[model samples]
Target chain A: MTERAIPWPMMALAVVGFAYMLLPIFVVVLAGLTAGEFLTFPPEGLSLRWVAAFLQSEKYLSAFFFSFRLALMTMVVATILGTAAALFLARSNVVGKAALRAFFLSPVVLPGVVVGFALFAFFIYSGMGLSRTIWGLWIGHILYSTPYVIGTVGAALAAYDDSLEEAARSLGASPWRAFRKVTLPNISQGIQAGSIFAFIVSFGQFEVSLFLSAPNAEPLPIAMYNSLRYQFDPSAAAAGIFAITLVIASVLLTNRLVNIRRLLGRQQGQ
Target chain B: MTEATAARATGARLAAPALSRARLTWLLVVPLLVFLTVFFVIPVGLLFATSLNPQTIGQVTVTSDLTLDNYLRFFSRSNYLLATGRSVALGAIVAAVTLVVAYPMAFVIAKTAHPGRNTALLILVLAAMQLDMVIRLYGMMVILGDEGLVNQMLRGIGLIGAESSVQLMYNFLGVVLGLVQFALPFMILTLVGVIRGIDPSLEEAARSLGASRRRAFFRVTLPMSLPGILSGSLLVFALSISSYIVPALMGGFRVGVLPIHIFQQVAEGARFQFGATIAVILFLLSAGAVAIYLRVGARASGGRA
Candidate 1:
């Protein structure tokens, strides 16, 4: 390869661009770790005092737990619904397949705030008593998260060869059994990845949570936004540290199980 | 290549189960279809319908009567007119800036060749992307806030007095910066795919024909990657225009974009009709952009998309 050495100019530009992307994160982590009371320049040295405070703080803890609980619920439902849809999209000769795929993915394509507000208005108008309730919030999270699961699982199904399942069926395996034994194992990685994404996206979601969160129970993103808006809180940065940890842990876990780069290709215009 | 892929697709379709398997699989999609119709389609569709209703605070149901009053008010009001212009400008600006900064990184990643390094870079981008928006904005606050690193450094270098630090954030500029930061990973990822897909032999052929490296890049590589640029920019535009958190946090409630207007009108004011009108305009704007993106993308990929 004649291009052994990347031109110094281009490399320098890369460094600058990377630094630009990374600088704010670095600042936040350091601020989260600061020993000082206020979020200050130089971070005034590193410590875990704020993180400890964050863990002990009642309001923040409750929000954290609520977020965790909501995300777990979102994960379970989204995984099931999304995986089933992915199978249908991949294997079935459905009418207007392209249009159906687009319809399924539209939740992701639409802005989160739009989805949130529309649902909020709907619940209020329809008068099924879902307004500003935990059930309403649950519905919002499911709507937002199911698309990500569909995307990941759909990608997985596309990559898998369906012939193996067909072969199993020809050898006298039932339709469900062929899927259970042959197709399921092959695409389980996608299911796992999809569920993890569901958990993570639901946890970090702010826009939808802003409109749909029930009274007296705020999601962590909403809580953090209020904290930042009204006052400066190191505990907020500490909360950030925890969110980053969740993202990193799940990403590494997914990477260990599957080629995340290939999944990333699904995020084309996302 | 197109013919081969088309044939493979048709073959795969032919190979699928030919019996009541179709009925069974269609059953799988029923839940999602019903779920989306109830929560997604009907809600969003109702919102569009509500936008046509005249301004009515605390009105839950769409009225039988319809008028253009809400739309006219939005069009007539200078405050709203300015907000719409500002939102579009912010999106356009963020898309341009993110593209320029992300291109170099995408080019480097696409050409790295080493699998380990490429994987590492990809993972890094994915992690940054997955990082929660609230947390990521917290980072932005630390650097762009008053007494932040930039202002502190500026003061240290005597660019400004301690009492007169530059307002780096809590304005339109801050929102732009936050959005660009948010959009960088997306732009980079979109470009790397297209850039890597471009045949190296074409560039090599240009180089062998007495062209410089820069000339080869400009003539062959850059033109080929145009699709990625347009796609990424369009995506970024839709994202920035519809974004609520960035402006809310970065602008400190001062930057009044369409989203902020909608939130204030509906969530806070309980003014459903006016809020729905704002949401409709926003939905249309982004939908137009996405419609263009899908069309352009399909043409670029020879209708494979």
Candidate 2:
């Protein structure tokens, strides 16, 4: 492809814009290393003491574990259900296809606050006890993340050829066997991409989780929020850095699994 | 006659599999539809119902007596009305700002020939989007705090006195800044897709037809990207209006946006009915905007919803 000259102004803007996006994250990482009790930039002395302290804290550790478990469950359930729905929609001449698609995807457009509030009220009205809050949270996260899975898997299915499944069936394979051996492998990229999105979204979910979480089962975001609210300490910065690192790692892993750009861009089914 | 009867029976057998396949398709989708209906749709429906339900304040009781009192009280109170208005206005501003800043970057990412650069930019935006909101807001607080990096830098450059620093956090400006940062990646990603879909050859054609670069972009590129702009803005606006953490943190719990108000009513005040009312209002506003956008998009593209 012949390279076209981009305007210098646009290049300059891109650099500035990227820096704007990244600078806060960079600062948080830096702040996490500060030896001072309070958050400060260009630290008086740099050390890993804050990170160490945050890691040693049981509160943060438990919150991390809870969030991890929640995310895993959400990923598994959402990926399975969403992939099935995507397969059906992509292949079948289902009536009300458009309406069904919108119904599944509406959570994407629905406000998180609304979802949180609604779920909270629903749980209360149903007399689900505080012990069930975790389940409530799980349900909410699953609902929120399923759309991402559907979008990715649907896009993948749209591009996949039905002839391959047909070919397998013609070769004396059962429908289930054809799907398991052929179709599944072919769409694994979409499934993996969707899983990553679901996991990340579940892990970082705040608004919905906030409403559902009881005192003892607080997720990482809520823990972090409470820490920030009650204390102005650098430990919060350390926690922030930890979360950022995890997100960056997930993004890198996702990039390896599939073209992240395409996954995000293919939401319109094109 | 027996041979003809056998052939007819075989034809019925041949049609069975095709009929079952269609049923199987519905079966595959049933789990998801049922899950969403019970967990998502019903809960939200109940929430709207709760908005109209009668409430006994100062106690945890809700009556089945239908009343518009909650909504009426919501609008009658100046504070609630102001917050609702502010939230919508803020959402609009954030959407506009995010689009303005993201468009050029997205254009570059979409048009650039350097695959490496494009991938790097895409990863940056993706990573940013995946980052936790609480963490990002914390980072923003540190950078925009009274004694934070921005202030320190300005002081070092002799822009401000030693005791004086800009009030970057704990106000409307701070909330807007945090929201814009949060919404940027989404807008950029959406716009990138739209921009990439537009044929570069179209711009060349326009240029060859005696159009300047700016004119070519305005006439050919910009108009084509309207769908992206609409959808992106709608998403950004909806998300921002529903945002709770950013405004709560950056606004120091003082800036009473609709979500925060709803949260306060529920969490702090223990008033679920009032909270539900605000939530219903907020949901309607954002959902209405999105519904309108979808209708327009469908009409323009002659596409299904």
Candidate 3:
């Protein structure tokens, strides 16, 4: 209730912390504008040549499109399945509901490296062909991204009053109609937020895609990884700027649709 | 109505239709359950199975015969053990550093009276979380490289000779810096939520009792946010240890950690068995941390269940 005086040390520490978080991103964007061929802090000359070059390259362009398509597919599938699961769990009196919730969220705890390896081995053992590796990557992305959707939608549903649905059912409305008209409209923001999160996650996913990607169908991260590994250039910084832009755009969009703080602050009960 | 009459009425109303409603609810979750069973649960099971299977040298195939050869080899090899040790140490250090740096920022964001500043800070943290890991690592490389930003600034300031710069990249320090930056946003956001939940009255009450600001914070605020600290540290440690891109790109293969080691074992050597073993180890380590955090959280909540 009282206006507390901010300590000088705390203020200094907070500034330094923000600088630490933002400096790398600012440096990368700055380097991408360099006219010089190599990555550097202060630009020899400012130009968007590297960004143009990366955008024009056929390999990078295709990787960009591939990542886009995969992310779109992942977003659609994860949203539907995760929303359905959340609806059931949130509305029903299911036995072992806590256990089921934990199971759905287990991927959040599972290390990405392990998930990559496990899914890679599973695909191999199942005799999946190279052509189907994209599908394999999609499945992997869905598994990883679905938990975010479920979490958001479940949080939204927790705040929802289920009696509205019951009232609709008590009337002439069918269960599906009641949900379609009442429930879906109420949680649309959460769904949109979750979809954005899912899309961003799938777009930037690296660990699982690193293993599951076929030789010719590399995602953007895998392509960037390969390029960085084999050759160091300012073009990678250009590509990084693009990635950062996409993330910023998505986060801002999510913030517009739903309160980003509420989405991220979700803990067990609160 | 009496409690017994109300309960009996509810029971009578629900007995006939409960089975059908339960069936519909079960049906709704069936798709997810089946999908996870095939995609997640089975694959992890197969990964465990593969870890147990032994591989013959120069052979692309692994034998189904059960053996601990993979685990034995991992333990016996000094390089592998060293990598695991370094990973644990690095994870701990990153978690600790991020916690220290993020606590004040979180406190300011949660407790500040200025709404606009808090919103801006929250957005920054969220944006940072969504940034791609590979891009962030690349950014760190540019900042920490020999002829990079830090050295460039230092040299221009006349603190160091033009011919000399600090060795910041292609080493352990670069990897640590990248991982800490990568994990800090998550820690801050988590701590913000926890810190906000603490009643401001409690801290004010402590202050009213003649406690200094520092003492109030140390005694009340810090102790109250222990759950957040535990969960955030565990999350950061697990992420830091499991990270591959930061170590591989920033460390320039100079730092060998468990994830990178497992990657090499599989990618370079085509030793799937060894990769699986390392994966299993990493999985258990992270899962163990989660288990411990859960136990502590349950106890902290005074065993609610």
Candidate 4:
């Protein structure tokens, strides 16, 4: 038998790939601050003008507000629905559980464009009048994000012990109280993780938003898409910077509460 | 003592009634069903119906003269077929490249004892979430454009002649780069889970059996992790094949993928039925690939059990 050593080649590949993943995102932040009106690489001069521009403009500011509101609504709706689904699948000796689970999680596989098309047509035909409204965007974002919540909460439920709930019940607690005290706290991490994911997905959703977006209710991503299509300007880059900052803040917030690895692990559970 | 015993008996007799499980399940699942049905199921059905409907250009009719013309045109047209083929080809390559890049990274993360590994992984996760399709595409444009980052860097180094620009943007290379960047995270994360789950003793046992390190990984670790490879690759492939934003933004007018064509037909041309047909085809391709992936993944894991 030969002695083993560190695989330097693998390590090198990992570092290079990590750099590749991070490089473009890193560049956007730098490019945003460039004093030039047009995007200049290596940032000829750094200034906060673009950020200021983003702050001052009614369009970008309103879009940012709209996106934030949409994301919050999505997070709340998805979490509640996902929590209910997860509870059923976890606690009940329900028949057709596998099929139901798959059905609920189907959004994960459906292409965003297809989902966008489906919702757009449905909104139009059903006479929902949701097209371009905050709620329409809310529904679209929720459909896109709910699967993550289900996945996360399901993972938490899988890892939880049933006896804990039984014990709570034995202590004169009602079924609802048992869940509130015994189950919710244990699964809160999963819910929080799922919440973060839902927020991000909703925040960055483009395909669904593209179909249903109106000027008044354009999400930041949709706004960026619209801007990029008609023109190339630093405002778009500035918006990109703003999004990146939000992502960083969210990630840091998640990290502060729970391990990111655990969150990711919960997300990928089959 | 007799009174207490009688009280305990009475308490036992007066038990809390169980919640009707059927009612509970219904309450939990009904909202989900309604939401998915309205937003997902019915919409897809509508899309299919709309695509099948027949409509003449410039006529606004709710009822379509049902026909297969749209599907036929998509299949018969050389340009559409070529674009579809290009998309599949590029998607396959991107999937493969992503695996090549991701496996090593996953391996390193799974094997390393570094303190910074967690931070690195976290940063990667956040970065993965941060790069929206539009921003990433725009960033690539700045880098791959005529006076973009790469060209500017090259110019600064005096490697190439001044004022002689390198034309890399609006091509297959630029598009693939953006797609790969977007898709790599899922691959890496999926593969990382697989790598971490592989029994450490198996690799040690292979090493003890006189297998070379690389041979050990290939023969012992890799085969065990085949499920991850299949799932991750399938995800990347499915995603890239149906991708709209990257191709539409970065691929430019020259490099037309199927989704871009679909977008153009519906959004730009108002050929709703024609676009739906293309969308259906794209959807089928994605569905077929996913079904195959799931079957393979099931076999890989199910056979193990």
Maximum-DockQ candidate: 1
lDDT of 1 by residue, A1-270 (tens): 565345677788988999888887777788888999876665578889999999999878888989899899999999999999989988877678867877787666567888899998899889878767767878999988998899899888888999999889878788999999999999999999999999998898888877887647688998888888987798988888888888889988888767876776655533
Model 4 regions lying over 4 Å from their true place: A1-5, A37-42, A170-172, A266-269, B1-19, B58-65, B114-116, B300-305
Query: A123-214, model 2: which lDDT tens digit per residue?
Result: 77777753236788899899889988988888778778988987786677777898899999989988998888899999999887878887
Name the lDDT value of residue B85 in candidate 4: 95
TM-score of chain A of each: 0.94, 0.92, 0.93, 0.91
User: Model 3: per-residue lDDT, tens digit, B194-227?
Assistant: 8887888898899999999889989999999988
**Which regions of candidate 2 are displaced past 4 Å?**
A1-3, A39-41, A130-132, A268-270, B1-14, B58-62, B296-305
Per-residue lDDT tens digits of candidate 4, residues B108-187? 76665454766567566566655577777777777787778889888889988888878776789877887888888888
Q: Which 10 successive residues of model 4 chain B have the least lDDT summed?
A: B55-64
Report the C-alpha lDDT of model 2 over B91-162, residue by residue, as the tens digit: 999999888888888988988767777887899898899888888887788889888789988998899998
Better of 1 and 4 by lDDT: 1
Interface RMSD of each: 2.0, 1.9, 2.1, 2.4
Between 3 and 4, whose lDDT is larger? 3
The order of the candidates by TM-score, greatest first, is 1, 3, 2, 4
Greater-lDDT candidate between 1 and 2: 1
Candidate 4 global TM-score:
0.91
List, residue by residue over A140-165, the lDDT tens digit for candidate 4: 88898998788878877777897897
True contacts kept of 2: 0.66
CAPRI class assigned to model 1 = medium
Poorly placed runs, candidate 3 (over 4 Å)? A39-41, A130-132, A268-270, B1-17, B57-63, B298-305
